[model samples]
Target: MLHALAEQNTPEVRKQARRYAEQRIPLLRGACVPVSKQTPRDLVDDAITDIFLGDGDPWDPNQCDLLTHLRGAILKRTWLEIRHRKLVRYSPFDLAEGDVETVLARERPHASRGDISPIVFASMIELVATELRKIETRDGPAQVILECWQVGFVERREVMLLTGLDDETYKLARERILLRKKYLPPRLVAIVEDLLDRSA
Candidate 1:
């Protein structure tokens, strides 16, 4: 269906694209954190344009349906807009005590340079630490791993060595941590939503 639409520039294809964008606008808006000066309609239109023009990432029909592919593209565009806004709003004084490069080096030595603001990055780390601490309250191995991660020993081998966990145990602890994604606390969600709103 997507291929057929992309290959032609007929009035019917344009009408279909408009209808698809209209249908997806509300859903994409609700899912994405808001960006200043960019509306959900804008994102939807851009995604549709990219897909039809072959200017964005290549779409694979075998991998997913057209709707799913369109959603991914819109979300990707939203993320990029958010990052661009962050970069535009960033100031040296945002990290008055230290520089971005220094903080990035200390907190995440393995992470590559990206558009994420240092202040936002630190907030994300704190949020992760808060969730990890909740897990640690019930799981001993989680506590050990969390402690190791706090001190920047995040490599699997290093964490295992410091925590004295075998491969299976380490994997189990990691799995438990990953499972937290399905059950995020409401307070955390509210906090993140508020941050996004303010950022926008």
Candidate 2:
């Protein structure tokens, strides 16, 4: 089928490819974290456009099936979108900014140019540690929230599959987590808010 898609430069071929792409939509839904700037449908549209364009077909009879290839493509696009947003959100990483590199170079004068500066790395670690500490509460809702945000268990059904919780239990845990956030420290709440925003 993919061979036909690759060979035929016709409208029918393109339509068929779009149809095939649509079939894999369910696999992408909740499989990837949501992009703040775009809907999942938009990302799916981008994936289909990639297929219709010259990006690799990714189908291999000997290696894997069509849905698997499409799933990988969807995931790839998700990460690409997130990284692009991250660059925009953290513009200091832009090499075009004058004196930024000089400051970093001065701070890490002994480090090789390829290595990430210790200052930047340490800040990232601090952010992660702070957030993790807040979420490591005695109640188990933190685990649920972290699993959903960090481990790609974005859907309640998916979390249920891994934790073996019933639908009602999962729903209650999610609600409890949200309610608990109200009482958390402002800084911790801000971090959790950002995570929620990014994963939306």
Candidate 3:
């Protein structure tokens, strides 16, 4: 089909072909975290490496290369970079921090479009909610909230995946999210906690 599109020189068809190409295993792995913690996101990242590059070491900068690294098994295709000394928007690593203030302090900038639709936000919230379940069952409710505040609203992966951004678009969108912390305040995490409690 892609060959047919290229041979026919249909720009519209080529665009769809690009979408098809992007939807391969890497993107799918890039989209979702595993349903298990013993699973680890780095293993997923390494699996993405194995799938895309046929090697397993995503954490090694010298041995493996990609545009970004998710920093472990849970974050196969996601990663973070310092937008500035004052800001960082790497979702996977952002959540990896041990302190809630550290995670919450790393706020995403605001864009008019960052106001994600309720259905989409609900879905992302559910994802977080599910992860929270694992954490809470293993730890305790306060620990869960602490973890929530740590990586709360500045979750770049949720924003990035929902937007399905290309590299340039991701740059613009992430930078905008970093600059507009007021729009992406850490407080929104509290709402997620309430949701979890209600469900419990």
Candidate 4:
């Protein structure tokens, strides 16, 4: 089966790869416990796609069998899904954890500006820009977020679209901002807190 998956590159081999993945659906489901219900299914699909696309090196004949390899793939992908969930708090552009309606109302274009005095708002923006520059190494999401902000993208949805980031990259960037937000000056943090308090 490993040989077929690695060498043949034929429909029969692809079919066999999917068959093996199907056999491990239960294992995948068990591994994805506490994750979204669709995660296991997505992992299986990813594994199958990997097999069909020949994305990874062929399974070493001496290292493992088809079942073992498929299970490992399932487990690996499941872990990534779990980690992503841990990092990501809400859907793109949604407010962090809090009163959803209130946050949304505050985040509205006009309302957000009205919520803060001009001087404080300018200070907050300057603080964020200065602090972001002081960070020697920024993660992908952080960089993307900074770029979006520099470009005057206040809306998450617009930032996402303009940045052309996939779901994982976007989530990662957002997570970095939340985690790194603490490093910002106290006043900046307070302003950010008032805006959106989702932590990494």
Give each model's whole-structure lDDT. 0.57, 0.48, 0.35, 0.52
- The 10 consecutive residues of candidate 4 with the worst lDDT sum are 26-35
lDDT of 2 by residue, 55-164 (tens): 65544445644444555566666555545644454334423343433443454444332233334333434544454556446657547556665756655556787777
Candidate 1: residue 26 Cα off by (Å): 15
Measured against the true structure, the TM-scores of the candidates, in listed sequence, are 0.40, 0.34, 0.23, 0.30
Poorly placed runs, candidate 1 (over 4 Å): 1-38, 84-89, 92-125, 129-188, 191-200
The best candidate by TM-score is 1
Give one digit per residue, the lDDT tens place, for model 3 in 11-48: 54334433333323222222232122222333333444
Can you write out model 4's per-residue Cα lDDT over 1-200, one digit (the tens) per residue?
Answer: 54555554446544555554444332222222233334444555666567667685455546655445555676556546544643553334433565423343354344332143233433444555676765446366677677786665745567788888877787777766666557876644444444332211
Rate residue 80 of model 4 by lDDT.
Answer: 60
Candidate ordering by lDDT (highest first): 1, 4, 2, 3
Worst window of 10 by summed lDDT in candidate 1: 108-117
**Pairs that collide, model 2:** none
Clashing pairs in 1: none
Query: Model 1 scores what on Cα lDDT?
Result: 0.57
